[model samples]
Target chain A: MAVDTRKCVGCSDCVVACQTENSVPIGFCRDWVVEVTDGTYPTLELELRSERCNHCDNSPCVRCCPTGASHYDKGGIVVVTHNKCIGCGACIASCPYDARYAHPDGYVDKCTFCLHRVEKGLLPSCVATCPTKCMYFGDLNDPKSPVSIMLKNRKYKTLIPEAGTKPQLYFLI
Target chain B: MREELIVSGRMNPFIDPHLNIWHWQIPLYLFLGGLAAGILFFAALFYLRGKENEYRAAVKIAPMIVPIILIIGLFALFLDLKHKAYFWHLYTVIRLQSPMSWGAWTLMIITPLSFIWAALHIKEVFPKWDWKYQWLKDIETFFQKYKKVIAWLMAIYSVILGVYTGILFSAFNARPLWNTSILGPLFLVSGLSTGTATAILFSKNHEERKTFARIDLLLIAIELFLIVHMFMGFLASTQVQIDAANLFLGGPYTAPFWMLVVAMGLIFPAVLEALELIKFRIPVYIPAILVLFGGIMLRFILAYAGQMSRWLY
Candidate 1:
């Protein structure tokens, strides 16, 4: 997933869309916007970035799961097997991005990257409903993919690379 | 603290960055697991070294609490599980990378071995109590016949269980406070120290009491050093690690950590145990009780502080 931070307006429409699409609880969210403010008052610079599960290559949540409940699918999307989850919260504690939570129904829940839609060759709900068209979802390995084309010229960065999580989410600044 | 001088790539507002998924039961399980591990290790050690008679309270009574305490710890773990019915899922596969997996396998092996260790000693301690039951007598005979092998196995399992408790926390890399390598040895020494104090509390012989006090004093001193090294490790790492170090130095976690774990738990007990080590005949139970309380509080602080730590970036 690649995001064009230049087009984001901190509107949080995608957040609401995700909640409705995934049936996320009232106080919970699968995705959200992080607004960063910089510079002095007279010359303040505001930046809004959409954030969610990175589906990290070195996902700690999957590594820490005792029952193999938190796992990666064929598309490399990290997901939880609700039935096998003992709800020990080990995966929740191990997630560096704070992307997981103990759902009220006795399972660790996280953003699935809209796996149901992706499996059907459809974009994620947040990517599809985004009014600014800032979000881009495609195989990074495919040279012709929009995400690959965007990364070729745009200056991009991932959050906390020093964590060694190797997050897949990229922000084009 | 000046807001007007904010720079680029500066502070950002992140909503709901913390997850309060774990509760008191997790910490309680860790404490009991460590304590049980300590008791079993020391008991097996005393028996192997031919000091069983000299340290009867430790060798005989310590293993006796192994099965009982671990059962309660497993019960606490069961209660903490959201899908308690699916507890068997933990045994379905083995993920070498997962500390929880290692712990589950370790507990499964140790729990039964611990019971066998206790049963071996039961005949020696209470010869007449189980003689009425034929099956109990036969089981005791079987364990007694293989007592030496059981002692060696218990000794090994006990150490694994003790270190596993600390590894379980340290394995969570997201929690910077628990990510250090020293936590393993720190917890092992604490378990040993607390186990020695418990043995001292139960010892009727002055020599046994004095022996345990001396050992506990040494363990406390080592625990102090390991804690200092833990903070130093944190300070020498990344910004996230430095923030985690501050949790103990001057952050909101400092009060409980210092008051319960350091002062009441290590310092006071160390001083009292030190006095007793020098043949000053102080009240052993007071310091013993304090050590146990402090040990439990240490787990509480570790669990809570670990949750507080995050990738602030």
Candidate 2:
């Protein structure tokens, strides 16, 4: 995964792209562009970063879920099945990043990496919709996958490396 | 404050958030659960001490009370929380700094222990019936062999469970009423008094009584002394805490505090104890039930009314 923050605007196109594709529930955005700006007027520097479910190898949410509603499939995408969920919002409170929420109907929902489209050999909606082509997604193990090659050559970091979640999303600063 | 959230003191009509209501309800249920767990553990402790007089009643009720208390606590917590959907989150947390976190952890451990203890009591009662199901029979025998070990652990756990409720509130530094160090000891004493009182009230006739009124008399006496110490500690603590002190001492909570806590909780129970001292035959159950009611009301009033404090002068 590659995130080129430079030349990238916080337009939330990835969020719209996700909602258009999945028809995600209202108020539940799979992708978010967080803007951090400090200082006043000319002294201010604005920075933008796109965030979503990182699909960590050691995902805390899946392990903490009692009903096994929130889980990671074989392909390493974190998934939530509405039917199996008992609406306990345990996942909502468990996520330290505040990434998940209980849908108005009581089911917990979060980013899924657009696994349905990925299965059909298409990039995630975020990667596909990024006008500046700042975001990249590929297999980490291939070494030949653009993500692995770029990660090896570029100075990039994952969100919350301290948590040791082993997130797949990488950021290029 | 947002225009929509403009809270009015006099006309507000208790429209507080559901989560706040749930917080109070959770502690109430926990106090009751802790009391039940404490009484059962105390009974088991007496049984292990070769009190043949107490062992029979312990064997009969010790295991049964916990599961009932736990079941009721769980129901109240879920109902009070309103949205049943996020209820699972209580089990998913592991934050040690949060008292609610400790409660979830302790309740998890106590729940299974109570269930196993209950199963063992059943096994003890129907040893011959267990022979029909070999696996169950084997499990029963295993638990039977380990009853003493389980009883001792239950006693230790009950102490933690009883006082932890007080510690849970005291840990929250923002609430002056709960922030006092004495609250933990106060809660523990109250837990024991309520537990002993409950046991006495529910105990059978003289032949199989689980509680001796003499013991409850002593327990209530000690509990009242602890209550006095707790108030004194709060009163002498700090001027910043003065408003809350006023609330309990001679303010909004004074009437319930006096009628319920002073009269019903302490005086009536003490009168029962005095009757025992004088060799007068007074039914212990009446005072026991009243004190138990008074103790529960104490928690209810304190938990809710305590939230009204503010730093704004």
Residue-by-residue lDDT tens digits, candidate 1, A33-148? 87777777778777678888999999999999999999998668899988999988898788788777767777878899899999899999999999999999988889898889
Residue-level lDDT of model 2, residues B1-313, one tens digit each, is: 1111211111111212211222456557856865765576666677678773554555555456768888788677666543476566556546554555566677788777788777766645556544566897688778878878877887877777777767765654444565577677777767777776666655665534324556656766777787677678777876536766777788888898878877888788778767765777777677778777777876777675555543211
Find the candidate with the highest TM-score and give its number: 1
Best-fitting candidate, measured by lDDT? 1
Error of 2 at B213 (Å): 2.4
Q: TM per model?
A: 0.95, 0.60
RMSD of each: 3.2, 10.2
CAPRI rating of model 2: incorrect
Q: After superposition, how far is residue B142 of candidate 2 from its true place, in Å?
A: 1.0
Residue B27's lDDT within candidate 2 is: 56
Tens-place lDDT per residue, model 1, B1-313, is 1222211111111224355777798889988988888788888899899999999989997678878889999999999988788889999999899999989999999999988877777767776756677898788887788888988998998898889889999988888889987888888888888788778877899989888888888888899899988988889999999999998889989899989999999999889888877778788899999999989999998888888889843
Every prediction's TM-score for the first chain? Answer: 0.97, 0.90
| lDDT computed for candidate 1 | 0.85
With a 3 Å backbone cut-off (N, CA, C), the pairs that clash in candidate 2 are A87-B85, A88-B85, A88-B86, A89-B86, A90-B89
